[model samples]
Target: MLEEDLLYVLALQRVKGIGDINAKKLISHCGSAKNVLKEKRQTLEKINGIGAFTIKHLFDSNNLIEAEKELEYIQKNNITTFYFEAENYPEKLKHCIDAPILIFKEGNFDLSNRPIISIVGTRKITSYGRYFCEKLISDIKQYNPIIVSGFAYGVDICAHKAALKNKLTTIGVLAHGFEEMYPKSHKKYVSEINKNGGFFTDFWHNDSLIRENFLKRNRIVAGISEATIIIESAEKGGSLVTADIANSYSRDVFAVPGRSSDNLSKGCNDLIKRNKAAILTSANDLIEMLNWDIETKKEHIIQKQLFVELDETEQLVYDFLVDEGKELLDIISLNCELPIYKTTTILFNLEMKGVVKPLPGKLFEAI
Candidate 1:
């Protein structure tokens, strides 16, 4: 059975033309939806934005009956609903400027316990971008952070897949609702994520997958995560919106630098140039920037174990690349203070050992 308070709130959410801010105002003035429903038109008219037309629509018996039917539909589907006051609601999201008063959940997972990092980017990512995403996510999974994404293609899917491989939890925040998953191809993978963690949405089951819903969903993604990472995004991609929202919320934003000529890299480069995002070359950079203690302790133990194995030049190169991703020749000459020819030899050796890759244009990137 749906709780009476939740039922009333859900009904309020279903009211046409009523948005979060207005709903909040109504609730604050009337004390609750039940009370709001009993108030006459004159009382409601005094509130800004609630004119006679809105009051009439809000109070119509037909609308109330339809809302009750919608509540029944939600119950029939067994979807769990949460209000902002619920203890299970995400605390981070509660502080968002336009936090949802109610959220509908369809899976079994504890959202509050996991540290979330939202990974977003272009739907058309390059092979290099894919590799960067996979390796970084694989490295960070040891800490068991919950990965959050929009379940779109490219870096979002890559991050979720990597998280699954590492046996970590992942959640996809959909723009629509539980009635159907968008871009249907993601259904299979989304099922896997739900089995591991869960899927989240704020819209009702019948809500259509509209464009504005996605922009709104981005806020939830940003709010839920401790930080946001842009793997690869074009100059005008949704990932930029997520990054902007994350920054607005005072969360760390990280961007992987891509080739300047690549169109997809423009957004990332722009972010770096504007000093809006930190340049992330590796998982350790994120760990350090976020002041993550788990990986730091683990690195200390691993360093002690490898103290004697690396030669002076190899050690210098490795140290430089350990917490940051660098171009092959860049680090060798920059850190070891060696010539390009000598650096190339060391990079070749490192590549042979599965530690680095030759990126486009003589640039070597560490794995």
Candidate 2:
């Protein structure tokens, strides 16, 4: 059964024109939406923001009909509605100043347990950006963190795809409502996520995807995540908004350093330079910083044991990649305890077998 508090909060949120401040005031004075709805005009007018204008609208028969329609729509959609006091409500978000009184969600994953990390960046991500995103996400999945991102193009899609590929639970916080998934092209992926993970939003199903909604959505992403990582971002990208929010919440922010000449990298570099975020060059850097309790140290031992199965030259090359995140074929050969020709050939065989990935300029990273 839907709890009384949740039903009241949902009813309040679904009201046609009631906003956050007004909702809070009404709830504070009347004790609950159920009680507020029964209050007379004089009682409501005594509240701070519930003036005569608000009172007229509050008791308008049409507004009551609209609220009923909204509740019906929510029920039809099979969406789980949460109030701030609900057991399922996100604890972190409950503490925010402008926390939504109700959130609508559609999914099965538990949002409260998994450590969340928001991956955000420019929508105009380059080939390098995509590659970094895929590799970084793949490495981080070993720790089993929940990946969070807006379901936008470029880095956002890349992050979701990588998380799905790695079989990790991911949450796509939407700026709009479930009535329509924005960016129609992402419908298929969004459906898949609903089945396997979930989507989050503060607005009811019929709410419009306005510009201000996205700004509001960013705070949810930052507030939920334990940290935020910017893969690539232009100087004025939305990813920076998330990072700034994360910083405000005292969450760790990490940025991947890109070449200064690259416009996509400018935001990340600026974040690191300004001391807003730590520079992240490898997955291990993030893992170490978070002090994640993933059995990484044990995995290293197991990896060493498996290394005994490799030939002498392959072992040498593997060790080199493990020690240094590099792409240069020459560097591997120079550092290996073998000749260049042998080292190069072994690296190719390893790459084919899914043990390592060849980066541009012949650099190889362990898979």
Error of 1 at 196 (Å): 0.3
Clashing pairs in 1: 328-364
User: Please, what are the lDDT tens digits per residue for candidate 2 over residues 105-149?
Assistant: 888688766778889998888998999999998998877888889
Per-candidate total of colliding backbone pairs: 1, 4
TM-score of each: 0.76, 0.73
Q: What's the lDDT for all of these models?
A: 0.78, 0.78
User: Best by TM-score, which number?
Assistant: 1
lDDT of 1: 0.78
lDDT of 1 at 213: 91
Worst 10 residues of 1 by lDDT: 358-367
